[model samples]
Target: MRKLLVTLVLILTGTAAYLWFEPEDNPDALQTDQELLPDYVAENITRTLYNEEGYRADSVTAVRLEHFELLGFTQFEQPVYTLFNEAFQPSWKASSKYAIWFPQDKIILEQQVVIESLLQNELVERIETDTLEMLFPDNRLQNNQPVYIQGKGFYIEGIGLQADLTEKTLQLVQHQKTVYRNED
Candidate 1:
């Protein structure tokens, strides 16, 4: 009789534990007002967050959570050309492989990254390691990867480049070997 009583107590305890700890379902799951939104989308629907132009990729991959945060990606493009900005104003063009966008931490361009800027009568050419990080507010470039650059009046090959097109200055990284040749 004692053994039976102990067994009954154990069964009751187990049932009580399951009732107490089991995950509960939301009774109000269908409420539309409770839905989560992306930060980019939540701020402004009329104001665009990111823009692109003349963009083409051999393959395009994208990831976003239900909340609309960019997560991860990998892509390939042939003869890729693009302009990235809130309005897609400035441009980047290349004949062969062009640019990449990493959605994780920042936008990163990878693999045979070539960029050209054509402004008025001047031209700028840049070739570097496949990685480049975008600077949003200033519309500039911040990259630590090895870079080779050729502009209207000079050529530069170095490791790391911070280019401010508005300033007309291409910041070359120090310590790494740098070669610059002025042409006319």
Candidate 2:
């Protein structure tokens, strides 16, 4: 029994020593590799600044950040602007009344929104319901709420829309809408 106990103690002590100071196997063995997430998203977002200047326009809008990455040494921040004409003169200025943020997978904007553009001799107006949904990566936007768009001689209203801002194209289904003169 004494011999058996001595052998067991020797084996346990040797094992502990090996584990405690085994030269750490490989220095890199203790290192862990980091990976970035597939994608990210945000909702209910609003950005405010004194002004934004582009080549030919200065404007402001309700900005939304969607599908971003914050890993490694890279920063992922995408701002989606929703308002009146995104293309305005360098002298354009306005205030945002509503905005929203969405995940890269799902984004919804709903509430009172308005956009106005001032050109040489006219103003373009676009009104949208507070409710909007956008899908990232592909940049698909669906506006199911009511919308009102007013141009030089056109006024449109309805529901059900598929808009691709990247393409600057809007397809909407107008319901019980009326267009007439602009007293403004």
Candidate 3:
């Protein structure tokens, strides 16, 4: 009789707890508006990136850099990323007002990003865009914004662009128009 009475008390307490408590649908719900601020910050950062050949392929200088652990990304202000050629000279220059480096070696430069090729290549010398996605190691750049390319006494405007810095190629994906001016 005592054991039966204890079991009944246990059952009643368990049911009462179950009725009063409920688990949250998401205990660690991600807050989209809440940003993981940088725990460590730096100023005037000069970071160099190496290629597969273990050579200094590119370098970036930023006025400020911040790393966000929860967001899993890094932010840069006034960044200048310069790519070097075989001669160790600056071949391409990419600068932006603001930039973010995400996981997997991808970079997004926003706010008036300008990419310039100093190789004296007639293909594409300068490209201006509001934002660009730069996949390092592959030396690839892409954007869906309006692009302006000027080089070799030729100017062109395009809606979208995909460029291979290593191959020295530029393809305007949409709304391409050659805006030529007579030097004569």
Candidate 4:
């Protein structure tokens, strides 16, 4: 009985010493070191932005959105973006399967991006590409991927595109093909 008690005491002392010397896994430190998580998440959200003049500039709707404030970016799934003209009328509409918006007035749209002109009698009615980048304050659309543009009576395919919605100008880096149909 005496030997058993001594051995038990020794085991207890060993356990206590081991526990006291072991490193602690601080939960707070672990969390801080982990990858950044979304600050907020929403479903079926619509948000509109206005210019300094209080005129509507752009609007975006998404099936799902995740905003990472710390990362200064927002991610969207199935997003549709609309750009308004100086008169506060919708001018261009863009849609994509996925998109990322930065606070620096930039948006990157990916996966089957389609930009359509809403203004009447526009030379280009629609533009399609796999990816597109939009820069605000200038209303520019740029991409290095293949692009397809459709107009009233003609359609054009190209390798790259640079368009200015404000100036109503479009330039294709490499023209692939063009087709025209007679309305008559």
Q: What are the root-mean-square deviations of the candidates from the true structure over C-alphas?
A: 9.4, 9.9, 7.2, 3.3
Q: For residues 120-179, what per-residue lDDT tens digits would candidate 4 score against the true structure?
A: 999999999999999987999999999999999999999999999999999999999898
Best by TM-score: 4
Q: lDDT by residue for model 3 over 1-184, one digit each (tens)?
A: 9999999999999999997896755635545434655868999999997768888899999999999877889999999999998777789999999999998889999999999887775567789999999997888999999998988777888898888888877788886788756742
Question: Which window of 10 residues has the lowest lDDT sum in candidate 1?
Answer: 57-66
Superposed model 4: Cα runs more than 4 Å off: 1-36, 182-184
Query: Least accurate stretch of 10 residues (summed lDDT) in model 3?
Result: 27-36
The reply for model 3, stretches above 4 Å from the true place, is: 1-35, 52-54
lDDT-sorted candidate list, best first: 4, 3, 1, 2
Candidate 2 clashing pairs?
Answer: 43-101, 44-101, 109-130, 109-131, 109-132, 110-130, 110-131, 111-130
Q: In model 4, where is the ten-residue run with the lowest total lDDT?
A: 28-37
RMSD of 1: 9.4
- Model 1: pairs clashing at backbone N, Cα or C within 3 Å: 58-76, 58-77, 110-130, 111-130
Question: Candidate 1 on 34-113: residue-level lDDT in tens?
Answer: 44333342211111244244432112222321233333333334324344433335444432343334554334556676
Give the better candidate number (2 or 3) by lDDT.
3
* Pairs of residues at least 3 apart in sequence or in different chains that clash in candidate 4: none
**Which numbered prediction scores highest in lDDT against the true structure?**
4
lDDT string for model 2 (1-184, tens) is: 9999999999999999989987744544433221333254444455443325533222223333333243322121333343333443332222223333433344454454443433454433454565666554344567677877666777778787786643656778767575767632
